[model samples]
Target: MKNQNIKVRKHYLLKMAFLALPFTFAACDTEDMLNPVPETSISDKNAFDTPERIIGQVNGLYDAMKDGQYYGGRIVVYNEIRGEEWINRLTNGVTGLQTWQQNVQSGTNEVQNLWGAAYAAINRINVFLQGLEDNKAKIDPTLYTQYQAEAKFLRAVAYHSLVTLYAKPYNADNGASPGLPLRLQAETTTANNDLARSTVAKVYEQILKDLNDAEAGLPLTYGSAVLNTTRAHKNTAIAMKTRVYLHMGNYAKVVSEAQKIVSGTTSFTAPTGVAHALQADVALPFTNYTTTESVFSMPMSDLDAPGTQNQLGYYFNAAPVGNGEYYLNAAGIVNDAQWPATDARKVNFIVTASGNKYLKKFSKPSPFTDYVPVIRYSEVLLNYAEAAARTNDMPKAIALVSAVRKRSDAAYVFPATSFATQQALVDAILKERRIELLGEGFRAMDITRTLQTFPEKTGSGLNAPAVAPSSTDYVWPMPNSELATNKAL
Candidate 1:
């Protein structure tokens, strides 16, 4: 958004920086990707001079991604608030009041911050990729390919997140609508800042290309559980493809990509690559972030947190556990008769305080350090099930949906009438998504991708009117920072 490069200053390429470094690079403001000061920064010239420095650069890419403004927290909070499930309890301007009310403008702080953070991470990836190639002879060929694939995967993630929020849905007019500026090359200076927006289709093409290359080059499985959960691997790329394809309304492609790792219809387990499958308890992944079910997550620690007022726990949990900025909407899926109170999801993740219900998925106390899930195996199964149902694979769809649902509600069974018609079965699967993925940030994406209106939300003296697909507010506007800095908008 700043039309500038993302540069790291002192101590960024530390050997022990595994997750994030908002503290160590406080002077450099590493999280502010749009405004990097080169005068006192560590030049990319020596970034890859040694193997340790190269590995640090790889970790740096992830640090950019987990900035509080991006995946570390706000992205999840914004997506959930923009949907119908959550109610504004505080109406705090710094938080997502405008977004939850569907009145966000180009100048909105959240809008500009998210846009800048995403591009900041993207520029860092580009810079890393170019440096890796320039210094290929110094590094092992296998490590070079692996690092390149990791950069590409991260780039794909950043681009996809930006497109979903700032551009029209891929399903909208088949992605013919205008998209964000596709900044692929490294931006070490302000010279290359005036690129025009590409079509949504073109942007998606690049995203898919990056993901394909990432899948081919990334390892099948990292040696450790933490690495498998936090880093991009072959299954991570494939799982991301299912999400991307589903967004484009490419059900066939979703199934095709999903089938590579999803081995069985009934059990629904990944046949290879870390042996991903549904955890016996839906709460296990939240408590134990490195569980096999967690395909990809951004890890946090006491030392490196998502920052004050930015953690998911701060927004959702009631006082004592969180700031209680927003509470669950009583009229939302929480009250759905289909999602029984006995369900494991309800029992483990929900809590009531002073007659108000709150989502406790990210329930970590102050300086919330809960890992944020990027994608999970259950979601993969659900995505595959949706694609299968849309493509007339009724049995496969039924089996997959049942697996996800029964995992949380083992005694529950799908009513015979729920599968009587294709529409009925599809509707059932959609509801399951709402129930299963509730506060995990799928609501806005699911609603928009399918061209459904944002359902009206009312409670806690706050009201957000339903936003139809035809409305300008359905998708966020390009940030004012971008308009101010980039000549092309």
Candidate 2:
């Protein structure tokens, strides 16, 4: 049965390609290029029979994942814009930095690129799911199950990214917090033109459903290290769950999910064999050539391609002196300390000169480097600490946080003898997360979610920048293209 389904899907794909040629050919007027288009679609009735093709398609998804437009481009920009680490005045040739800070509505390439890349991923996943369903008979049962799970995971991830940037936070009371238009089908027709925005709650529910299925269906690990590094797995799904729960202000669930990983209840173990805490040699932590601290990372190579680059290196390193573009404040902020004196992480990764600190997270010299980590074990540890603190498990929270600080050679951990309240603990945790996860595409979402969870923390006078629940800036506006086409939005 599975075999027959594969044959059918292959035939359908071929037919679709043949139908698309007219459009492809029409666009090429005087195309006497090196390569000519073939008249007929390639046949692969047995293409689905091999794990190679399935894996290849999955790899293609990763390629799309790392596109400069999506995580590869705008994600880093988004992170920089939201954090105190960057000042808008220093941003040159950075398209959206001004609009982002002023909270203005503007259409720019960065916004369009991010939107397009996300939809491209969603479209691929939709097509893959559709193909699997069409050819379920020819597919091995286990293979089909795994493929489906992968598709769901990708879909969930795409939606989560979209919602975080383009829609309002879930409000149980209002039920109308603007959300992105949901596109679940592989093919679109005029009949589906009037798609409306799903409430934040609805989108979150879908995200949870997809992740739950992914967690259940994906393998404990993949056979190839490339696959292990590039693709989604059970542990990644588990980690994502912790993220989702945290965003939703479900502290108990965050604690539950993070604890499962931290406690080593299953195959989802912390980076062992080597210490999993921050290193005195800060550079050693980032050198991660043979470590498993990176639970999920996008694979890149020096080879020029659409989705491969050492993004961290390109943005943070000093451009002339090193390769970085932005300079950090060497004297440090009015309230914050400079990068620790003897900590190797700071010494190796940060360049200090003329009262400015430049980033060295990506030690590579060129824009191209292999692999960019999206999530790491260190993040999981912090998530566990934050969640535990929220649930009044201060002792465990302090221990986890202190362990991370000790590794960095910091003086002390949070919830210090002077700080006694939950709010105080939350503030300390937020500060730790900012310092630890700086330039990692988390600050904006953290600020948004925190505002939702604690409306009073929203703070201040009328002109003080609409903080969280009080303002609409919490969610970014949908791309103009989406709004024009999807009336429901």
Tens digit per residue, CA lDDT, model 1, 214-302: 99999999989999999999999999999999999999999999999898756877888889999998999999999999999999999
Give the runs in model 1 whose Cα sits over 4 Å from its true position. 1-42
Query: Per-residue lDDT of 1-489 in model 2, one digit per residue for the tens?
Result: 657645643443344333222111223334433554343232333334455666556656666667776766456556555444543323444544433353535255555557767776776676567666777776588878887888898888889888877776553333367577777776422345457888788888899999999988888777555566567777778788888888787879888777655753212344322222333444453565334566677665667432432266665666653444455532222126533455445555666644557666766666446356677666777787788888898777766666665656556434354247766766777766766666667867777766542121111111113244556555566665454444465
The most accurate candidate by lDDT is 1
My TM-score estimates for the predictions, one after another, are: 0.92, 0.80
RMSD to native for every prediction?
5.1, 8.5
Model 1 Cα shift for residue 411 (angstroms): 1.1
**lDDT values, one for every candidate:** 0.86, 0.60
Candidate 2 error regions (>4 Å): 1-50, 89-95, 104-106, 171-176, 188-193, 223-226, 264-282, 304-310, 321-324, 329-335, 410-419, 452-469
Candidate 1, overall lDDT?
A: 0.86
Please give the distance, in angstroms, between residue 261's alpha carbon in candidate 2 and its true position after superposition. 1.1
